[model samples]
Target chain A: MPLNADQAHYLFSVMRLAVGARVALFNGRDGEWTAEVVEAAKKAGSLRCLGQAAPQLNPPDLWLIFAPIKKERTDFIVEKAAELGCAKILPVQTEFTNASRIRQDRLQAHALEAAEQCLGTYVPEVSDLQALQALLKGWDPARRILWGDESLVGPAQTLAGLTPGPWAILVGPEGGFSEAERAQLRGLDYVTPVSLGPRILRADTAACAAITLWQSALGDWM
Target chain B: MPLNADQAHYLFSVMRLAVGARVALFNGRDGEWTAEVVEAAKKAGSLRCLGQAAPQLNPPDLWLIFAPIKKERTDFIVEKAAELGCAKILPVQTEFTNASRIRQDRLQAHALEAAEQCLGTYVPEVSDLQALQALLKGWDPARRILWGDESLVGPAQTLAGLTPGPWAILVGPEGGFSEAERAQLRGLDYVTPVSLGPRILRADTAACAAITLWQSALGDWM
Candidate 1:
């Protein structure tokens, strides 16, 4: 096993790790691997795998499909979601959204950085900007999406009441999900509409809270 | 009760709300108020409170004490915390914190706008930055302070299992709390070390998640 060019730059330039240093590596599919640097270069480096250090920790098959806000907030969402062990990160577009040009490569790099920071084995894939309608067209019933529907009007809806299954958390943009989007969500039988709480959370906050609730409720808290 | 000066500007200039139009207002103290423009003026507008529509809603007696980061994030935290209904906000300086200039007036305006947006009556007060040790010197044993201690290596602590009293959430800066700070935190009987999860969350994410957890456990819910 060897460190990728991007990983090498982060380890060397960003973190300043030197030659003959040990670093944990995981290919998302394989279990954790401990690798030591055999060669160090500014842009690229090489490492040799010593042994498997830890088993791969699978995410909860949770997808975080949120409408990206500004550049920084969008980056924050991806990084936080990756650290929180989300299996997939999706950027969707809805009405009233302040459209942003998605730099998919940079965002993917952020996901990698967050995974490295949290010592997670898996890096959730970030999807391109897709229209909300196009996303609903190919929805699978088995993957229950827990909607952070702020307008659900009460605190009765919570992750504690939802049945565990393959899941996704859909959060709207800053302006929030439109009336049409709400209608579409309400019509979906498999969409479990839940409120984060009585207060109105910003879109980013709502996503994190929803994930925490699900993780606390159905994920690995036993 | 009309919108504040900043609110008036946003409403009239940005939102283009015309004269005689109605807008909703809440202070988290009084109930939601329905107010109408008595005169057309952006900088100097007049409005008459028609009546109280919804009764006032109270937030939990919790405080948020965090080290200031960049200007925008500091503003974001103030805005979000106000909307999330924290009773008070305090800025603390830890060993590794960078010097951050505060625009108190602008932040106070942001909090007001966030409150108006969320229709919350109670707005949290933002405090000036002070040394963490000085703030805790006169700590009340009756009121517990929970630290979102990232270094806590154990099972994910639940806020539900913690005490229900006047509480504050301690979030260090990006550099994290120093060893001496950690020792002080651990030494206090009133200090409860809690984990957002096994993940290393950014300070902002930790604050939101910590508040959400506390709200879910002890605050108002169905």
Candidate 2:
């Protein structure tokens, strides 16, 4: 594939890759491939695909839906979500959500960077921010939503029994879900309220813990 | 207990707590208690402790032993370790570890902050940086060590059947363990090497993932 200006800069300026250097590439759908630098320059560059290096191996159909907190911490959530094998990232607008909006493109970049750093073949797509109520209205019942309910304090309720298929983990904002939102979530048949642990984790930490718990219980980590 | 200068600054300046304000307090050994601010100042403060509010709720006896990396990332590891219910945090100097020294005091402070933020009654002790060789020499055989082995590929090997007791999770440096270190870890009988997941996790992320997996499988989170 012909490299863009940013890609060229990353390769030539940052990575210091010269002509004839080999690099690995993956585009989520296509398997990882070996690409040789055919023409390398600071402004423009191109790579010729050599061959497939690895078959496409995606994480389980898992999604991470979380309310955006601070910019850096939101970025951390996206990065860790990608590393922890989240197939999709959704930023939700909750009643107590601190951030009014999120830079979806920047979050996507963060996910891409995380995937690259973690040696992940697939990069999870980061969706634009959506209202929590609106998201719940269009929710798919087939996909189970694991709610990290802070109100139910104790050891994490085991997610063992639920058969793994399509799943999502919903983490609330720092202020937690409103009573109405909590009631709506509890009323939903698809929602399975689970505790992370006895301690009340920060928003970013809760996201990571939820992902790790889900992965360990029924996702690819098992 | 009388507050130190830093603690006083945190309480009076950062938190903006007024005299007579009730604040939660814990000292690792003692149960959580409600304290009334008797004297408040920017440089010094005092609190009068009331009766215990909550009994001591300690996490399972789990230790996190990790090779020191960059300063900020090292601090992150300590914070996450405390939040994830690590009873002790041990920074070890491996052959390939990037950081030569660590501010044990600062890291301990980070752990304390994390514990306070998470509403944890117990704070995990952060040990001074120790040589990996010396640490291994005094290793307790009875306490199992979960080695986050990067060499072992694929999904995490389950800790399902393993009985919960005193345990430790060891995470290597960003550069990863040297060949000799890898051989030594593999040779240890108490070490149960496990993969966090299929993808390679960064040192900080690996520590969090390892802790989450351990907690889900055997720790108090279960």
Candidate 3:
């Protein structure tokens, strides 16, 4: 397969791979394969697939829906979500969300980059920004949402005994969910309010921690 | 207590906290206290401790020893380690470590900032970078080290059934441990070789993941 201009530049200029050098390649659909550099140039490159190195492995059907924070932190959330084996990443605009808009393509690119760096066969799909109310309106009851509630004032709760199935983790904004939003979430049967720990965590850190907790409790980490 | 110049700038300049403003303070010895800013300036400030707000809370006895990676990522490791409730953070220079030197003061400051941001009462002490061999030479027999060996290719192992006393998580360098280093770790009776997961994680990610797994399994998170 012919490498894209960016990939070609990364291979030839950044990695300095010459022709005949083997590289691990994965398309998310096909298993990871060993590819040999057949043609290499500064701005263009091509490789021939040698053989499958490993089977295409997918993470659990877990989704991460977080309110976008700062640009760099939003990228961090996406990148960490991918690395922690989230199947999908969704950005939602909450009542207290600081960021007005998010670049979906940029976040998707970050997920792809994380997958490559973490040596994973699958990249989580990053969805466009959506309103929290609208998302709740179409909520699927079958999928449990582990709500990382910031206002939770008590000892931390464990994710043990949670059913192992389709699950999602919801990380609130920096300012946390508005009163009305909290009430709404509290009223939902599918939402399980959880605390990361005793201390308060930033939006980005909470997102990463929530994923870690969920993956360990109900996801594939066990 | 008199605020340092950096703290004064952070309060008066960055946070725009004026004189007479209330700020929470903790010295890791005393409980968290609500202090009033008696004097506030961009470069100079002071606050009188009013009263205790909460008791001093300490995390479980957990140490994180990791080989430093890139500059930013190394900072990230320290910050995350502090936020995740590590009792101590130690940077170890391994055979495959890429970075040459680590600014101990800078990393300690990062831990302080993380503790302040995360509302942690206790700040994890960031030790000066030391050689891995030297660290192992003085290893405490009672404290078990959860060796995050990248070479262990398999499903994630549970940290259950392990003694719940003083413990540490050891994350190797980006290039991973040398064969001799792995052998040395494996030969040690106090070391428990463990895998983060099936996928290969970056050094920083592995540190965070290993901590999360350890905390969930045997630390205070349970």
Candidate 4:
């Protein structure tokens, strides 16, 4: 397979790889494969696949839906979601969301980088910023949403006794979910309100913590 | 009580607080208090305590000891530790730890800011960087240490069945613990090796995840 300029530079200059060096490769769909460097150059390179190293290990059917915050922190959410084995990442613009738009390409790149960093065989897809209301309108009831409710802040209400199938963890913005949004979420049958802990975690920390809790209770972490 | 120059700037310049404005205050000892700004200035300020807002709620006796990574990430670890209800933050120098030193004052400031952000009444203390071996040598057998063992990376080994007492979570550096360090930790009676999840988590992510797991299982979050 042909390597991109950035990949070529990373392999040749950064990693100091040359011809005949074996590199692990994954394409989201295919399992990890051992590829030999056929041609290595400053800005271009090619690799020949030797054999599959490991089977593809996709994350459980879990999505991370969060209201985007600052640029760096939003990037952090996406990166951590990928590292924590999230299946998909959706950045929603809630009533209290400060950022109206997000650079989807940048966040997607962050997910890819996080996957690479964690030696993940698959990279979770990062969706563009969308309205939380619209997403809720078309929400799949089969997929349960674990809403991080600030009002329930105290002891963590564990995911115990809650059976997991298709699930997503919803984290609010820095300003927190509006009253109307909270009411709507509470009224929904599919949305389960959960508390992180006694302290009010920042949006980024809440996202990661929620993911950890879900994974440990109902997802693949078990 | 008198506010320092930085606190004065934070109140008058950043927060735009004026005389007669009520502000919540905590000294990590006394409970949170409602204070009115009796005297406000550019470089100096004073407040008169009106009443106590909330009782001092200290986190469970939990410590987060980690090998410092990059500068920004180290700051992140301290901030999250404070937000996550860690009683103390300790930076340790391991065999593979790249950073030899850490700014104790800056990290302490980060912890304080995190406490403020989280509305925490108590701020976790950030200790100066020290050698991991020295820390282990003086380790208390009563306080069990949950080690983030990378070798057991696939699936999180739950903290269930482990009784809670004084406990600490130890996260390794990016390069992971040296073989000698791992052997030493494995042989220690007080150390309990645990896995975060399937993927190779970055040091910062591992620290937060480990703390979450501990909190959910045995800490106040339960």
Best by TM-score: 4
What residue pairs clash in candidate 2, if any at all?
none
Ranking by TM-score: 4, 2, 3, 1
Q: On a 0 to 100 scale, what is the lDDT of residue A93 in model 3?
A: 96
- Comparing 1 with 3 on lDDT, the higher-scoring candidate is 3
Residues B117-204, candidate 3, lDDT per residue (tens digit)? Answer: 8778899999999999999999888999999899874567777777899999999988899999999999999999987766788888
Question: Which sections of candidate 4 miss by over 4 Å?
Answer: A4-6, A13-16
Query: Over 4 Å off in model 2, which ranges?
Result: B1-9, B13-16, B41-45
How accurate locally is residue A141 in candidate 3, as Cα lDDT from 0 to 100? 96
Better of 2 and 4 by DockQ: 4
After aligning candidate 3 to the native by TM-score, how far in Å is the CA of A134 from where it should be?
1.4
B105-210 in candidate 1: lDDT tens per residue?
7777787777776767777777777888889997787878888898873346766677677988888888689999999899999988887776667777678767
RMSD of each predicted structure = 3.3, 1.7, 2.0, 1.4
lDDT per residue, candidate 4, A1-222, as tens digits? Answer: 899999999999999999999999999988799999999999999999999998898999999999999888998999999998899999999999988889999999999999888889889999999999999999989999999998888999978789769999999999799999999999999999999999999999999899999999988889
Off by over 4 Å in 1: A1-26, A29-36, A41-45, A50-55, A95-101, A156-158, A178-180, B1-18, B26-28, B41-43, B100-106
Candidate 3 per-residue C-alpha lDDT over A102-171 given as tens digits, one digit per residue, 9 for 90 to 100: 9999999999999888778899999999999999999889998999998874446778778889988999
Candidate 2 lDDT, B1-222, residue by residue in tens: 789999899899999999999999888887799999999999998999988999998888999999988787888889888888899999999999877788999999899889888888888899999999999999889998999999886888888888788999999998799999999899989999898878888988999998988888898887
Question: Per-residue error at A87 for model 4, in Å?
Answer: 0.1
Docking level of model 1? acceptable
lDDT (Cα, tens digit) per residue for candidate 1, span A1-222:
456788778889998888899988788878689988887877888888999987787677889999989888888889878877688998988886787558888899899888876677888999888888889899888998889888874563545667777899999998788898899899999888887777777787788778878777776532
Best prediction by lDDT: 4
DockQ of predictions, in order shown: 0.43, 0.74, 0.55, 0.85
Residue B192 in candidate 1, Cα distance off native in Å: 1.8
Give the C-alpha lDDT of model 4: 0.93
